[model samples]
Target: MGSRVMPQGAQDISDPFIERHLVIDTSKVNRNAERGGFTNREQNGVTDQVSSPRRSEIVNRSLSAVKSFGNDDIDLEGGDVEKDRDKTIRGSRIVKVRNQAVLSGLAYCISSCSMILINKFVLSSYNFNAGISLMLYQNLVSVIIVSILSLSGVISTEPLTWRLIRVWLPVNFIFVGMLITSMFSLKYINVAMVTVLKNVTNVITALGEMYLFKKHHENRVWAALFLMIVSAISGGITDLSFHAVGYSWQIINCFLTASYSLTLRRVMDTAKQVTKSGNLNEFSMVLLNNTLSLPLGVLLIFVFNEVDYLSTTPLLRMPMFWLVITASGFLGLAISFTSMWFLHETGATTYSLVGSLNKIPLSVAGILLFNVPTSLQNFASILFGLLAGVFFAKAKMREKSQS
Candidate 1:
């Protein structure tokens, strides 16, 4: 057939008759090319060979069409896409949790250091009883400030109810115990020694959890607990001196701290039920606890006959006193939040280990800042105690893994 040409704009060249004829003509040409200089028998022998390339060319053209439309690309099924998204989300969550844990640890350390500095500086310039009074003043001021902030919407407001008050009452009592004992320890002991001894709380808490709450722990936890006890005792014996008042207060501080942690955990677990509220924010708890302490502290000041010191000395008027009190209060709050957050993020054992590491820097800072004299024996004791804490913590983690 001669080349068939379409008229100008002839219905956009839609012609099945022309297409059929063109295909027939192309087939004839391919047959002629295959039989070039070959007899019929030879052409028959090469028929399969000639058909193979033609089939391949058709396949290639089809593939090219698919490529042009991007249809040949692999299409991930719905399930596969969802699984990939889930994996990404899980990874992000894990990273976020770990970051929170680290931030909490650092905050606790910084707060601890700040509190130590402020307390030491204040005590060096004032009487013990007077310093206690100043602490009370600081709490009072904090409560007032926090209350104002809450009302102004800078801080969140917590619902106050009888049930909430009942639950918070005991916690505040424990808080008071911790504060008074810790402050008393500062009077006779260096900040470094006090911090080392503070590790004893971990041991005490473990026992309290086991005995009181019936919380089962792994063998490693017990081992860690044992190490902590031994370390604390050894550290104490090595660092022992005739500072009876300070030593006694530190022992009380340890007990109080342990009590605080145990009680706080219980309170946190049952806060919603006990308060008849959905959940209580930690800031609200802080506010309530500190507010309750104000009256108790005032009453204690009178009982201890420290009201005279407050009246005679212009401690409140001194900028140094205000500075120390403000700094210490903020540090106290920071430490409180960080420690709680760490416990929540990494569990008790890891939190305790991090706390143990904190003692070294605190001890060094104490000696340097307060001129705390230490014998070689005392230094050795501290080192041993720290090592024991590490071993115990590791053992506890191992036990947890096994269980």
Candidate 2:
């Protein structure tokens, strides 16, 4: 060995060194067999033995991590599914609301048309205070109808009290004014002209809002208002045929109607407050207003010498009269419900826009059904009326934005 210790070829190992290496490898193999019963291979040689319990714990931890990851993925997928379902429900609700608004607008237009047709065809056939008497009878009939509905639990009852009465008094006056002025105007003017002239209320409402309510408007709204006014005036003038008394009554109608609309907005707001306070119900307010008007309507009939025309037998005998009265009452109730529904669904501006469109059909119907004449001047009046409505709408929109 001393002779060959000759560098051991730098590759050959001595007996003692090789024996020691073998012993170490043997010990490692035995330890692996005793513990895990296996050994891991390595590039250099062999890896040290790992414990069975420790290896099992390591494997278990990895499996737990995988399972947790799978659970997290499942939770995320479930959340995504719920979110999608909620979005689908919300979209459906929006569609339902839009449909309701359209239906309400159509109902309002139909009711208005029915009223006009009845006034033109049926009431015109009767004599003095015929319109007034018809109105009075209709109110009485309405009271009965409403009372029946209330008793039947179809309509909810409201309390009667001074505070509630006072709040609605002004609104009731405005309502009466609306009915009276429109009827009076119809008596003097043709339906087409009346429809066209009604547009003027838009301008009055705008002016009232600015002067009385001190509302500010946007430039676009002002521009639209101007355009609407121009359109109405042009339309009216183009279709004009002068009937001084008719025109006068129409103007009065416009004023009264504008007042009614403006006053109603305030009254409705106040009524809501009173309702919340448990002082009144809307149905009760309606009943009280009509009941109080019973006396006023009767007095007016006598004052206007319309009592002579008011024959209980003749009125009852006339099927057409009853039809008109029935139609009018139904229309009135429908208008109330539809207008409220429209406002709830689409807001005031949309309501006004639909109202403006109503004139077109009404005017056409007036001309075709009632033979109401149209001229350049009348057209201009229509244009002006339309313009006024547009302007009023703009003013309202601007005020809302500012607020």
The candidate that wins on lDDT is: 1
- In Å, residue 338's CA in model 2 sits off its true spot by 1.7
Candidate 2 per-residue C-alpha lDDT over 1-403 given as tens digits, one digit per residue, 9 for 90 to 100 = 0000001011111111010000011111111111222223221322545469888678656655665565442233234654565567667776776687778778867765666766666545454245666667656766666678889998776755566677877766665655665666667666666655555555576678788889755676566556655664565456545567667766776676567656655675566566545533445555665665677778878977787655554766878667766766666555545655555566545655565556667766777776666765665566466445445555655556566
Residue lDDT tens for model 1, 176-239: 7667776777777776566556657667766787899997777666665576566667767777
* lDDT for 145 (candidate 2): 67
lDDT of each: 0.59, 0.55
The regions of model 2 sitting more than 4 angstroms off are: 1-95, 125-129, 166-171, 218-241, 260-281, 312-316, 380-384
Q: Candidate 1, 28: how far from true, in Å?
A: 80
Error of 2 at 308 (Å): 0.5
Per-residue error (Å), model 1, residue 235: 3.3
User: What is the Å distance of residue 184 in model 1 from its true position?
Assistant: 0.6
